[model samples]
Target: MKIVLIGGSTSSMTVAARLRRLHADWEIIVYQKESYVSFGACGLPYYLGKHFDDYQRMLVRSIEDFAKANIQIKPSTKVTKIDPNKKTIYFETSDGQQNTDTYDQLFIGVGAEPVMPKIPGIEAPNVFPFTRLEDAFGLKKLLPKVKKVSIIGSGFIGLETVEALGNLGYEISLIEAQPRLMARVFDQEMTELIDEELSLKNIRVFNNDSLVEIVTDDQGQAIKLKLASGQEVETDAVIMAIGIRPATHFLKNTDLEMINNGALVVDRRGSTNLKDIWSCGDCATSLNRVTGKNDYLALATVARKFAKVVANNMSGLKTQYAGQLQTAIIKVFDLECARTGLSEAEAKAYGYDFKSLIIKDKDRTDYVKHQKPLTLKVIMDKKSQTLIGAQIVGYNSAILRIDALIPLIWSRTKVDNELEQLDLPYAPPFSRPVDIINIALSKLAASLEEG
Candidate 1:
């Protein structure tokens, strides 16, 4: 059996690795548009910040490694079109050489692309949409000569880039069209805390203002930005991290089912509507475990899990993905934040009668030196009395406790006296008298009873 995978993203590589292990005799081929494959895109900001000198450290595996397993790795090859009915794919090489290849099974993991908004002077040489490794490399080369940088959008990538570049001693101006930073991920209260952290770091943030135009110099380099709020600021360069949309335009007009943003719709088994065709990654829709609906979460975690499921199903081992909670974690300056499941707005939109409570407390006992504050917010279904969502923000490893709460939310565990008495470990250096999660659950229970 001949299998072909498009795009050398985390999901594509994962599917290839697992499939090769399961079916060694089958022919496997991967077409990658970039020169490098299996590199962690998430580490781009850190690498650009000089946290790691060697770019090779970001690569999980090399082309030679995949080739050793008998998988054909075609780097710098772009798959322009796929004919599902004919079971053939047409691609163009870097040299403009076009070719056709047939496959018994095809996996499309083209991933997502950064949203490039239409604004005057957006094509400036100094303006870049921070997405690919090449973008990071280019930014690193430019940062030495650049004094100030403005970042558009305040999502994970935007925030990370701000911190990364800020650490390098560059003046940063973070512009977000929304009223708050990370509006989609964190609640208003949590965002307030993040806003404070950013302010402390001297990162100028402009919110509720959209970029109306990009002012560039004669050299076609972004120099300033005109905001819709009648504000203008001089900037040395601009990084656009507005958002991403699924990179599935090539599959347009095909019978394959897709979401509004072109993310391929697939079942729990990672099988698309078309037979012998599977897709997983940022390019495909994922099942949101909490909502029991398909969602397009452009996260590496979802892509990796779906990759294995697709590989197993193709190897005759029936398997199912357990969906996702949109779980995500981010580090902004010194504050670490994590959230799982839905936010308050999402819960309300889903028509769930839910109650949420935010608790502020010390992460550890006062006896511990340098103890920091932590915040925990828990959302529980009013009818079911179970956790539907949770968000945590704090310093040190306090935010990581979200790991323990994930199971409660995933299992839909009911909030009760027994759950409140969960035997979480406690230490002066670690936690307070009662774990923050337990305390938050206890508060949630109390609120539920009063209602």
Candidate 2:
């Protein structure tokens, strides 16, 4: 059997590698639009911050290595069309040559593209989008020459780029259309902590403002950003870190099922509405474990896990993926923030009556050293008495303790007296007699009992 994959991203490469090991005899081919494949796009910020010098280190695998496994990788190629009836795919080669290929099964993992906001003079030379490897190379070349940069949007990439460029002595102006930073992922209280950290690092924040236009100099380089609030902020360049939409524009006018945002909708096994065709990645939609419905949670963790499920089903193994809780973590200067499952807003929107407990305590014993203030928030469904979501903000090591609570939420474990007394490991050097998680659970349990 022949398997053809479109878009050689994390999901595509993972499926290819797994399939190669499972079915040595099956023919596999990958068509990638970019010159590089199997590279970590997430590491771009670190690369920009000089955390690492070599750009080649971002690569996970080389073409020559995959060739040894009999996987044909066609870089600089685009899959233009798909005819599910004939199981045929039409692609354009790097040399501008049209080609056709047949596949027993096809996987779509085209991923997403950075949002280009609608604003006048945005096409100026100094404005850039920090998404791909090529973008990283271009930014690296320009970073030393520029002193001031205005980043539009305060989401993950936007905030990360702020730290990366700020570390290099660049005066950063972080502009956000929302009133609070990272509104989608963090609550107001957590966002306040992030804002404080950014202030300490000399990053200027402009919230509740929209970029109406990009004012350019005579040389056609971005000079300043005109905001809707009647403010013109001077800058050397701009980074469009607003957001991203699925890169499945080529799949339009076809019968393939997709979400409103153009992300392909697939089942738990990674099967789309059409037979013999599947999709998984940022370009596709997966189930939200907490909501129990299809959601477009575009994280590298989700892409990696569901890719295996797609490979298994295509390899004749019956595999099913449970879904995702949208677990994510990030570091901003001295503060480390992470969250899993649902948020208070999400729980309420999903029509669940929930109670949330916020706790502030010390991470470790006084004599143990490195004792930092830790803040944890837990959301529980009042009716079910089960954990629905959790968020943490604290020191580098302290915030990562959210790992223990994530599994409980993922499993929808009930928060009762028994759970409050969970036998978690404890040592003065690592945690208090009652760990932070246990304290949060105990507090939550007490609230439930008070009813």
Candidate 3:
């Protein structure tokens, strides 16, 4: 058996490694468009701050290592087209050379691309979106001598970059078009915590400000920003952490049936609507198990999960994937923010009346000397009393606890069933008698009795 994987990021590398282990005789050829493979794109911010100076440390494995495992690795090579009907793909080598390859099984993990907003002077030099390792290297070379910086977007990457660079003593201002930073994930109260934290970090944040124009300096490097709010900010460098879309435009003219945002439509098992084609990672549509809808939730966990699903069915095994729960956690200073499932607003948008409870509790005993922790809210369906969503903003809070809640929501299990049995570990320095998750559920159980 021979397998051809078009992407070499987290999902494709994970699947290819396993398939090579399971069927050692199978010829597996992995094509990675970038020079690096299996590196943490999430660490781009830290890399910019010079936290890890060695660029070679970012890579997990080299092409020779994969060759040792009997897997053909093609780096700096792009898969130009996928013709499922013909069982072949048109590819482009890094140096502008063209080639074609045939495959028995194909997997695509092409991931997403950072959105470069259509604004005047956006094409100006030094205006950048640091999405890949190469982009990180390009941006890192400029940060050392920079004085002031303007950042667009206040999402995870935006805030993280703000803190990382700000800590390195750069005057930074972060701008977001929404009324609150990370508006899509957290509630109003949760956002307040982020605002306070960012303020303390000396990173100026501007909400409700949309980019109107990118101004350049005499040397043509981007230096000023004009916002929709009639505000002008001057800076030496402008970094765009705005939104992103799937990176499947290479298959644009092909027979792939994609959504409006260019995401290849895939089922829970990562199999596309097109025959003999499977896609995972940030490039494809991920099924929301709770909402029963096809939405794009580009998180690393789902990417690996979907890759396994494709690897399983291709190897002639009976397997099924339970779909995705968009769980995410972000760290800003000492504060931790995590969320999963659907929020209170999301449930109402689905036309379901839900109840949400806001809890303010100590992470540990008042005399225990453990720092204060706050769990913002727990949103649940009133009819079924199930855990629909939760947002936690706490100091030293357990981000993994929110991760544990994802499976509960995905299984459609009731909230009361998991109460008092979270089985979280107990260490005085970390947590108190009952974990915060259990405490919240216990509160919910008491509320049930009160009604």
Best by lDDT: 1
- In model 2, where is the ten-residue run with the lowest total lDDT? 394-403
TM accuracy, model 1: 0.98
The TM-scores, one per candidate, come to: 0.98, 0.98, 0.93
- TM-score quality measure for candidate 2: 0.98
Better of 2 and 3 by lDDT: 2
RMSD of candidates 1 onward, in order? 1.0, 1.2, 2.1
Q: Which stretches of candidate 3 lie over 4 Å from their true place?
A: 398-400, 417-428, 433-435, 449-451
On the 0 to 100 scale, the lDDT of residue 299 in model 2 is 87
Q: Following a full C-alpha superposition, what root-mean-square deviation does model 1 have from the true structure? A: 1.0
Q: In model 2, which runs have C-alpha deviations exceeding 4 angstroms? A: none
Q: Candidate 1 on 275-362: residue-level lDDT in tens?
A: 9999999999989999899988999989998899999998889999999999999999899999998999899989999989999999
lDDT per residue (tens digit) for residues 375-412 in model 3: 65887776787778877878765555676677668777
lDDT of residue 391 for candidate 3: 79
Model 2: pairs clashing at backbone N, Cα or C within 3 Å: none
**Which tens-of-lDDT digit does each residue in 340-390 have in candidate 2?**
999887888899999998888888898976788888988999998999898
